[model samples]
Target: MWVRVTILGRCLTDGQLALYRIPRTKITYSNIKYDWGGWIMVGLESECGNGKRKSGGCQARCAADGATARVTAWTHTGIVVCASLALVIGAPARAGTDDAAGNAKAARAPVKPVTGRKKPAQAAAPATPPAQPGAAAPATVSRAWSAGPGTAPAPSAGGAVSPEVAKMIKFAAFDKLSMKGWITTVPPAAESIFQDPNGLRTALAEYGIGYVAYSTNTFTANMLNNAPPKPQTYQGQIPTTYSFSEVTVSYDLGRLGLTGGQLSVGTMLTGTTWEPLGPSGAKFANLYYFQSLMEDTVQLQAGVFYNAQNYLGLLVAASMATGPQALVPYELGLSRQGVPAPGANFMINLPNNFYNKAGVQRSISPDGADVEQQANPIGLGLSSPDAKALFIDEFGYKTFSSPAQGSVWVRAGGLYNTSPYFDFSAGRKTDTNWGFYAAADVQVSQISSAPYEAYQGYYVGGFYMTSDPNKNMYQNYYEGRVYGMGIIPGRPMDQTALIFGYTTLSKSALDFQAALTGIRPFGDYASVTVSNSFRLNPGVYLMLGTSYNVHPSATPRLKNSLNFMASLTTAF
Candidate 1:
């Protein structure tokens, strides 16, 4: 089988074959052959001595032919894979006169004998392929093939030709592919509180050690000093001065050879005195890290946490740099009052950027030793000291988001304070308590040219809880609240919070209240809270707020009272 080959430098990009072999002579043909397994260029005289082909090699020198050179053929060998995860082939060296006419003379390496047992013959390479895209073209690239029969050189020895089909390729190139935001908290410029107070927090976070602390000192003044009007009336009982502070340290144990989680510990430090208004301390806000899963789709959280939104994300007790406490969720911090307990939280990421979380923990003492007893049965939500209590909470979120339009989230949460707190018998309390809530959180920003108000947040929620009358507290109660936060235009770092809340006690509780107050005080109670927080800077902030309360319609179950509170807060 004889064939002609185009030597394009160190590479052979094209090939053709001649059907009939021509004896040692100066002639060329284009009929491609396919049986001998290799394309033979200039054929040598077959010196068959005793029915076996002899090694009758040929030699040559440069001839004054301006067009082509000598041709030396090599039997197809092995192919090595190439390119950047791509493919390329190194052509075997040819050594003989190689020219288009097949007889041009030139000096090359000596020919060697083909030995060993004959193996199955595979077809030699056929057509030349185009240069790789993005590759710099050499001064001499073989004829460019478009696609069809006369265009692309036929397939290679590997069989089917890697046809050089024209393609309209598009791509992109960037200097780098990296970005960053929200390291530990907002950077100083965008934040008014705890802006990396000491260069320590920022430095530590950079080093994978994130530590944060916050302190809030609040002083309240009542225009109408009044105790709960009726013995059972749930009204303003705020103390004059109270302070709450916490410090949390999170260590990225991944740096210490531990993996998949960070170790965090938070301590409440001191407990508060008042029942309703806060500073209510329950030490060790958080004790474990155990964030085993971190993916958006599913996550497993174990360790100690604030337990519920009340003492966790709710800013009513402590403000977050993100925004104001626009909604005052129920004080669901009974068992783990501003404290952290051993528990596990699981989160599932749903479609459309929605998510759900559920968690449970030993009410207080894992061994049922000391379950935190409530100070005001109503305020503490039925945490009994005799029986073991298991706090269970589940919450879900559905969100609508847009950079320009801002974001909105619809949230539903339910908690089962599974503890028998009812006074069924003189000595035994067997009633269980539970509550549920649904709220919407909205935040609009001016990231883009949307007509959304900059720095605004609004939230409204409805809450209901099963109360016990024999406990001298609320019996079957329900409440709702609406609150909002917005930056007064031109008020640098200043924000305002306006909230309204209404709670109605069940008839049983109302009846008890009527007996205590002598008059059947209506079962309804209402209050309005207004607060303005001025961020002097990232390290300091001042908040002045007031609450106006209106008790039931009956005799002064609780007279209208106006309370004002001032707080100076700082964070690190």
Candidate 2:
């Protein structure tokens, strides 16, 4: 057991104080009159005095005059004297063990009447000043202990266990943890939230693999006249056109270790325009009637692709297709002829020069009208015939990086005809041709961030036919050969060609894109093409373009011919 006591008044040396607690059978007292004026333990006191007002048998008296004393008990020891001063009785006056002599000396020195100074009214019992404004109240402290099986330890102030810990404890006990929220956009700007989800959807739809285009071609021919002082010329033409567009929708089933893989199918339409490369100049036999060597076709394909990061990706596809013949003019005919002999039955003689010119030489006819006359006997359709062919094409591509920066991609593929569709005279021979193609593309940018966008990229491509020994045949008859011609040739039988292109996009007050493409037949025809597109607003665009064909073997005066077009496009 522990005990505590407090006195309300001051004490003089030699004074005493007592404390008591009733019914405990123990008495404790203290002498308040010492050097360190506080409680001191005295012997147990016996209860005495009046029945109601008790007094102590063991009492402590002050040793000096004017000294104050108080006593409390552990068990009803005595009356507690809380006065500031009390007369001493039978007490020491010398401040030591001697009392009588000390009292005598004090009496002799203080005989003068006590000065009327009312003892400084005992200093108002030292007060506990009212709490200062805004002061922090004393913190409450609690003490608790638990004795149970598997109980947790109590937390301490300023300890490792925190309010956050308590919250987590409650959450862990009653709720499921979850995180759901939107990530705010940064670089706060007008379009910061313009995240273009559609663009992302489109990209994702393409999976990771992409495509490239390629084409190549060449031309050849020879002509001779045998009369002296004769006017002679050689003419040949081959035109090749190919257009490919593919949109793929793919989903990644990551569980299969094929994260970047996808399935894609697309459509490709190829057509070539070919005419005689001559002084008269090559002209589309059907252009006057708006009939272009144009053939539109659709292909249904499916394949798997793998993209490792954005750095590289590849695709392999097998496709079955049906459309206009890839190769043109199902049948072909070649012939040499001598000038017809003068008509002896003429009623009158013609110019002497005419007769001499017809007699001196067995020369091939420049127009070959006689060949066409003899060829009609075969009853095969010429350049003007309509027929479709079936074939399968295998395609693949490897892309190096994102299109935003410089990137290189390689593409190769082959088209194989599944039917016996080639008959030159029947306008189907070009249908049997097949070929391989490849190309590369690159882009450079000025700013990597946003706001101002600018970039440039260029592409080069080539393609070679495997079975078509007459390359110029397809170029001269484009509509007939939809799959295997690279360019229009100046003459017959040329087998190879190449095409190069460049494009640039820039943003200022307005956004614009421009591109230039050129096709060259190894030794014959050449053409320069230009295309441009501009944004009129957020979702509207305008396009304009033109192409000029130049034939070196044609009359230099008529080497260049133009084709132009314009269009408006909109997006939702």
Candidate 3:
């Protein structure tokens, strides 16, 4: 594992020579300083091979007045190791390219570099970044491994990373990370396997590799309720709101330049701790690809179809948009229930305020839910289909006003799904026969005058689904939402919202319930959802939310269901 050497030339590091690659020479070094990036010469010669001084060879030293000059003898016999050289070697690079591809054999047990967490909503974006990839320059070394530890830091038998290589390793391992890595010694506080996903993602992205990871735990418990087939929970029927972790990794082949077309393939996973690589909760784990054409203006996406966070935004503008539209849903699409879904879907979008999507999905029996049926060489869970369906949606965006003229953005879209998740007694095969929804949102008041990103917005929409008329889930429904983002002056991370909506069940559904159970089930009922999200730090957040059914039943019309929840979200 020795690195051969031959002085290639002066590294034009603005006069710094951290690394110089020259072929066909064995490893031998006398003095090497990563500080201010010193110079090193390479030749098939050594004066202090076994600590025995030979008479005629060159001496390396830190020029007394910095890069301006040098004061050393070309015929010194002993290796001249600079005191500063020890400082830089003992410290690792904070950011640079990944380890060279040729050094695979000497690789140590892999370092965990989790990145790109798709946090629940807007939180899904990568965590707070350290610095852009291009900005990862030679950072100033503030401290060194000069004392404390009994053993001084040393590279593996493969030799210490050149100041250049060190930068690359440091960049990939711990660039822009909140939890710094200790090259000289292991930091005492380093206990968790999860490091900074944002930093790792940044480093990878620099090399056209994509990375994302995040974990979430949310609870939804009824304060008062009396219903059969209760929720599954350790707390006696309390339903877990959402508890899962997910990751996405991708690489752009177009950036390589040799390829004429731009293409990127990404793999995403959502799973529990027991099965970290397995797909759970709506079965969103799958592979997808992205293509850039027409000079990056138009983009295409296809593969396992999972509705991205913002199918529509009643409050937040990004991924965590509230409502049933967000969250990669299992019971999503037209024929399915109100949730996101997974299947092979295709979508197209661009910066011109135009976007379109279409996809087909088939439902599976609850028995086939947890297990994945593999396909050919590299596909998962492609063998189950309980309900066959297709969905299509197109939308356009327009700004009614500008930031300086008072912010107002309106978004409208129409969606239709031919989903058959259920069958009814009179009209069709299922209670949820077909569904069509048209929606519009207004970014009413976003105080651009404020010191932070502040906003007040609302939306109104209607949805209609058909059944056997005797057993309809939602005949025709209207819903509305009012939310504010970062509106509390300096508390820019805080978001508050109140969502109220009504779903009018068909008369047949009510009558059918009465005849079958001797009790009239809920009819045209209303519900309210409220939430407050507090961002502890840009990377961590806490959410407090609650939902209640105002009219619990049709005939009795009693105030019956009240649910409350709390959650801690981490993006890494």
Q: Find the candidate with the highest lDDT and give its number.
A: 1
Separate clash counts for every candidate: 20, 55, 23
Please give, for residues 261-348, the per-residue lDDT of candidate 1 as tens digits: 6676666643333333232545555666554443335555566554543212222222111001111222232333343445666666
- Model 1's C-alpha root-mean-square deviation from the true structure amounts to 25.8
Model 1: lDDT of residue 149: 16
Candidate 2 lDDT tens digits, 1-572: 11112222223334542322221111111111111122221222232222221222234455454454443312111111111111011111222211223221111111222111111101011001010000010000000000001112222221223333232222211111111000100010011122224444223323332211111111211112111221211221222121211122223322244322223222212122221110111111110000001110111111111000001011001000100111121111111110111010101112321110000111112123233224222212132122222222223332221212322333333333322333333433333333333322222222221101111122233322223333222222110001111112321111111221111111110111111113222233343434333334332333333434443222212333343423333222
Candidate 1, position 280, lDDT: 53
Instruction: Report the alpha-carbon TM-score of model 3 versus the true structure.
Output: 0.52
Against the reference, the lDDT scores of all candidates come to 0.36, 0.20, 0.34
Error of 2 at 169 (Å): 35
* Model 3 lDDT on a 0 to 1 scale: 0.34
User: Could you tell me which 10 consecutive residues in candidate 1 have the lowest summed lDDT?
Assistant: 168-177
